[model samples]
Target: MSSSLLCLVFLFFTIVAEATYSPGGFHHLSSLRQNKKASKSKPKLPFETRYFPQNLDHFSFTPESYKVFYQKYLINNRFWRKGGPIFVYTGNEGDIDWFATNTGFMSDIAPKFRALLVFIEHRFYGESMPFGKKLHKSPETLGYLSSQQALADYAILIRSLKQNLSSEASPVVVFGGSYGGMLAAWFRLKYPHITIGALASSAPILHFDNIVPLTSFYDAISQDFKDASVNCFNVIKRSWEELDAISTKKNGLPELSKKFRTCKGLHSQYSTRDWLMGAFVYTAMVNYATAANFMAPLPGYPVEEMCKIVDKFPRGSSNLDCAFAAASLYYNYSGSEKCFKIEQQTDDHGLDGWQWQACTEMVMPMSCSNQSMFPPYDNDYEAFKENCMSRYGVKPRPHWITTEFGGMKIETVLKRFGSNIIFSNGMQDPWSRGGVLKNISSSIVALVTKKGAHHADLRAATKDDPEWLKEQRRQEIAIIEKWISDYYRDLKED
Candidate 1:
């Protein structure tokens, strides 16, 4: 996938790309899709939207540092007792409410633990923009936005919330999936005094500094389709070569647009190709067993569905037609947009914000090779850094995340302070390759599943959910219960 398009999918689970990122009545995709016939009877939770300060320089204290901006958050105490446990979601690249609406797993387990569910927005994302629309105007303002500072924000906000609610004794368990999941784990590593444990679901915690190969992401995406049907992978691989040939011919751009049924005439073949690549990447990420509308209106088993489309390559039909037909399954699922537009501006999913993150500390090396289903593409680190410098005047820090947090030093952290943390990963998820898939210590566990997608275990439980997820949740609940029990026991011992 192109770097820009790749940034778009990073927020596929957290940011709303097609729709507005507003706090309104939005139901879980699994529940809404399942209850299409009984939509009127579905009960809704009354989540309140609130904000907090956006400290410009979290490390330094100056008069200009005290700037306040809206950091949106949602709190649900419906199942909480006076001194019950608290469940906090470290929001990712999009709106906080988006994460809150989709993370029904936290709600499903909240009542059992009598926990208060809190979803805090990440800085510079969603409505938590520190500089408002002028965020990217002055590059200096963006300096305040970093993973370390965001973790500090959570620590500060949680402490303030505890004092305000008089629930200081409540054992806090941090929960997050994907990028948010990385934050959850790092938060525990940095602030163990505040959070008792963390549930890092489908987090690519080791995707940096050669811990996992840079090509692992696209390779896993290729495997998703290959596992479904090798024919699908071959056809997709051939489609790229066919597109390259077509673009070289006269009147190729218009002919390509006509074949794809695009609403607008094609301007650049590169953009169109990148958009299609992103579609495939997004489909693999949200290939749940049941229907979900997280990033797009995706049906259950999207990769398999995509394969079904690719397999029906009619005799004599052009290769471009076969590829376009498959791509439409995702881009035109809603049938609302007249043409496919790869907008470079900010999307509902905060694509622009995510792009800035990619340019800076969150530089996950994305490249394509012969090993992947797609053709070879250059992933030059120097070129990537130069592009970042040209765009944001910031150089890419490829080793920053691993340097601050434990990348290869994971075992050391586990030996020293890791306990009651669950790193759940799905076999089908490309991000799983970068995550922990083995038990590092007595209390640190990794739950792996064969039939799961990216963070599928983090969504609301459905009847169609695989048995592995059911078993995973059971173990997670038991572990959390023990953590809470042990915390209070240690408190008494002290």
Candidate 2:
């Protein structure tokens, strides 16, 4: 990989990991539900949590490969009928329960379709560790944590589930958002016979191998702010240089600490930059139509709300202060947090697993140029490689994702072999830059929404949902119905 590719890889993973897995991170949707005040009338959870004995290594024949670990999953069979179709949520980088709770669309439609809802936790995430905490101790142990292995796990589990339930004739539809969405699409491609269809919302399967512009991700983020408020966008773009200048002066760090209300005071510009960047990137990811608690308790159209805060600053106010206020809207929206901590440690196992994956097969290259709102940074593959080697005793296989999943010539490749896969993307999401934005074939369809952010379509329906969002979900359901109907028709014909 080129140095530019390496820089992109670092930037992409750093933002995603921090947003999705870090404590109080931007994409911690489950935290929202969990943090809500409990009520006496709170409804009981609909699904039952269970575990499966998953193979450590599905390909190798060694003794260690035969070792099994208990993988976690959740199943809700209340709406299932005999021979009903199965709906599975391929879990992402967090706990299965978080996804299960946040993804209300499935539950909303389960009764209508008479489908059984199942959420399978990805191996090494949540409570599905193959080798416990020691899984991260070496490359050999972490080698079992690839996407291929996780896909195989899903396939085997689905087959076994069908057999146990005596529903081998039942059709299966998989649902995932973001990384899980990528898995959903690949599962259909790699194991088409196992699943009838996939709903891959905001899956950036085209992020690898220079398939998309290196600056597209940051550019989309910049555009989101620009769309919200041009003045807010310009303030952020100019504030970086101002921050740099302020950091060099005497008592500058303390001044920044006072302005940003940092809990541990400012040490360097890097942490402050990262902290601010996370708020922007994550807010973009979950910028739903209505107020949402996906990342934090944020108002409706959070990017716009953040922009409103920035634009409200008085004429003589400092741009740095304006930026901090905007970031605080994301970080302190609930008004519960006293002071912002620049860095904090977390016990999330998924973070560890993701870092290992980023160091290995999950390399997606990204870089920013002068044209982007972000500061220009050069990619350094040698430095990236050395850092990976020192930390994990491994080198990143930057080409492995495309090699395994087919990012290059994706439309042609998928049109030839893929079917019943919905590539749904919200233009507001930065990840959408690497997503399939056009229809590949009749069965392989792309559903693009301009105002949508991240996996807005996968979230549970709310009365506050915009008409376009509601229509998107209805179209998705209709497509899945056709897939199930077609599968049964084929079965009868055969």
TM-score of each: 0.90, 0.92
TM-score of 1: 0.90
lDDT by residue (tens digit), candidate 2, 1-494: 11211111111342221222221123332222222332112235689889999889999899899999999999999989879999999887656776776688899999999999999998888788888866456887888888899999999999999999999999999999888888898999999889999999988888777788867877898999999999898888878888778878899889878777777776665566666766777787778888866656678899999999998898877777888889877777878877776644343324456667766776655556776556666544566567678778998888998888888887788878778999999999888888899999999999999999878898889998999999999899999999998888999999
Instruction: Write candidate 1's Cα lDDT for 376-461 as tens digits.
Output: 66556776777767767988778887788878878776777767778998878777787888888888889888877878877899
Lowest summed lDDT window (length 10), candidate 1: 14-23
Candidate 1 lDDT: 0.73
Q: Pick the candidate with the highest TM-score.
A: 2
